[model samples]
Target: MTVPKGKLIIIGGAVDMGSNISAQENILQPNYIKFFEQGILKRIITESAHHEASKVEVITTASQIPELVSTEYISAFNHLGVNHINILDIRTREDASNPEYLQRIRKADVVMFSGGDQLRLSAIFGGTEFLQILKQRYQKDNFVIAGTSAGAAAAATHMIYRGSSNEALIKGHVQITAGLGFIDSVFVDTHFVQRGRIGRLLYAVASNPGILGIGLGEDAGLLITEGSMMEAIGSGLIILVDGRNMVETNIYDVEIGAPVSIENLKVHVMSIYDKYDLLQHKLLIKKVVKVENGVFIKADK
Candidate 1:
């Protein structure tokens, strides 16, 4: 398999873009401020080859409130000192084929997908020239593809389109479909911890042990390089469910709507600074120590 030259930043839901809450609420909740002000968005800019000069294209195709999301993202990026940003409000199949949008995509350094419905992303850009250009750029250039919520979920080869957290363990409860195919053999689910989505992600992996399941929590994300090396970022948790060592599972035999059973399914929880290798299926953690100056520093494990 050929390794990709670009980067993929997959973020869980609830990334505050300075539009979700009022100034008073933001002042009261400083944590939300950190997420946008000095967190994931900042990292996205830093990872770009040209940093602030990178031409960013915000694809609001997945969002229902495209205008609101576009305005919010523009504010967020401007706050981070990134001025070259454009919002691509591609809402229809024909819009996905627009020559102007295609030209803009060719020159863009970073492409960001906002949170909304994953199916819209797949149905709209699945086989279009637009997706083809994005894939080519990802494979050959130092491009960056960042997505939050539904955008994150649709970055993988297989996507979980429908699944109820309460009944996720039941056979056939979780629905799977082809996604944008930016990454393979991986299934990503957003709003993980906040919505209790582990059951659905587990079921996805249990059904297909070859596929790795990643559950991303709100305000959390992973910065992936070479399409394999993943560095955990943001302030929330990230769950990895590995079913490769599974000894037994009754998902196939169990009747629909019945609870399925699985044994020896391995799970790993990660936080900021943690690293996970998608190809090797290994986890590496970073240890930190606080100094006398009341500052934290990395320490050798």
Candidate 2:
């Protein structure tokens, strides 16, 4: 059977919530209030299964602190009034194969992966039935798979296992490994601008020109529909590193620690409301809207 495409909500880390921040610190800040009141979790809840009968299954396998991460997600989702929420703490390969956990994946309308070590996610659930069914559901059913940070990175086929910002551009500096393979056309990175991951993402695209690089900034996310068009949401930026037109490179000749040389790398900075066409490798500009005399109107063509 041909697997149908589903939506993906890929969030960068440090998404705003009251869990980590002290109440006293955010009491006087409007942005903090907004962050707590209407952040990515709200969006996730809205896009998940039917409001009256939604079933959200959160997988906290990536995190070392699974209990804390699961609790935070439950608290956030609960605020949105999702009907049912469950956390699958599949810590070991044996845990991944648990029949109950497998049933949870089969019945969930939305499956969310929490942030932690990407390698742990890959190592534990790489070839298990749980992952297979999850992929199948995403392919054949109207399922939603949302992930943040490490979870976001592992959603792609090719994942960046490890790399340093300082030496990212140098050949052999970044390590690549097989990920869950939910989306295969692009390599994803999170905590992007906040953590200075541009270099590593650039290198990933440079080495494999066939794939595009997505760098999601902290507090930002990309809501992808039909597996192609991406709508940027949240408070930060989304960086698209397109190397299709790259003209020059010295990667093969360079030493391990030598700087990489390349030219004509195209990049697009997308913010909230901006859309990106992944298949065409282009940014889709929306109709410009303007405020005229306190009235909102679309700009004339």
Candidate 3:
């Protein structure tokens, strides 16, 4: 019996009202994918991956991670075979940084974080018990971990919260920082191209050229596993920025709001039906949209 370990699905648009029904089934077997796609079932699936889950637990570090941002979440659980549901509402500043609450994060087969303020999530659970629990679950049980927007932002070792391409690189330095270490050595940014976050991820890469920068468009996500591999799932695309190839950077010397010069940075854009080797830092699958991680975004309004 080769039990299924788990997979992480990070997506861009189609976050609301079944916009992402196609990819939600990534957590289930292909034979059972259809059941998980139904609107009602997905909601159950989302809620099940929590406290009630004898084998899973859902963690919400952000206040905005409600049904409004993800209507199908709770229902996703409805269709899923997994059984568990626990909502972690550590929204306040005090609660986010609380170590005790973070400790309870361990009892889960799937530790998921809802999207909101990447900074707030990081500040609350970055170095606390919440993070440790996730690491253990993922490494030991191959728990299915997932996040979007701010939630996705907090998955990487180096995380970007807020930054403006209009502003100078140094001006936005403190605006971003390290997020939860779900995926180490990668700087993650949400609302990516649509929000003009390339500069921010570039800045993170410039700070240290060893890390890879991953930008997830709204309604898009990347399913990453331990074998140094990741699958692209969702409507949008996933951008992989390899800072290791960076050669020149005048980020610090460049004036705020002025153009900065950088080169030798490698970039790969991936779309649906694609895969990336996180450990190899290369694209193992075809680039659906020419691997640009296209910059298109559908408004929430």
Tell me the TM-score of each prediction against the true structure: 0.93, 0.89, 0.72
User: Can you give the lDDT of residue 177 in candidate 1?
Assistant: 95
Where model 1 places Cα greater than 4 Å from the true spot, the runs are 18-33, 291-297
Error of 1 at 47 (Å): 0.5
Candidate 3, 123-158: lDDT as tens digits: 776665556766666666646677766677777677
Give the Cα lDDT of each candidate.
0.87, 0.79, 0.58
- Candidate 2, lDDT over the whole model: 0.79
* Candidate 1 C-alpha lDDT tens digits along 1-301: 8999999999987875555541111223423534555578889999998999999999988877787677778888898899999999999999999999999999999999988899999999999999999999999999999999889999998999999999999988799999999999889999899789999999999999999899998878999999899988877889999999999999989899899899999999988788999888989987866533422245545
How much lDDT does candidate 3 score?
0.58
Screening candidate 1 with a backbone cut-off below 3 angstroms (N, C-alpha, C), the clashing residue pairs are none
**Candidate whose TM-score is highest:** 1
Which is the winner by lDDT between candidate 1 and candidate 2?
A: 1
lDDT assessment of candidate 1: 0.87
The local lDDT score (0 to 100) that residue 151 gets in candidate 2 is 85
Candidate 2, which ten residues in sequence have the lowest lDDT sum?
22-31
Candidate number with greatest lDDT: 1
Q: How close is candidate 1 to the true structure, as a TM-score?
A: 0.93
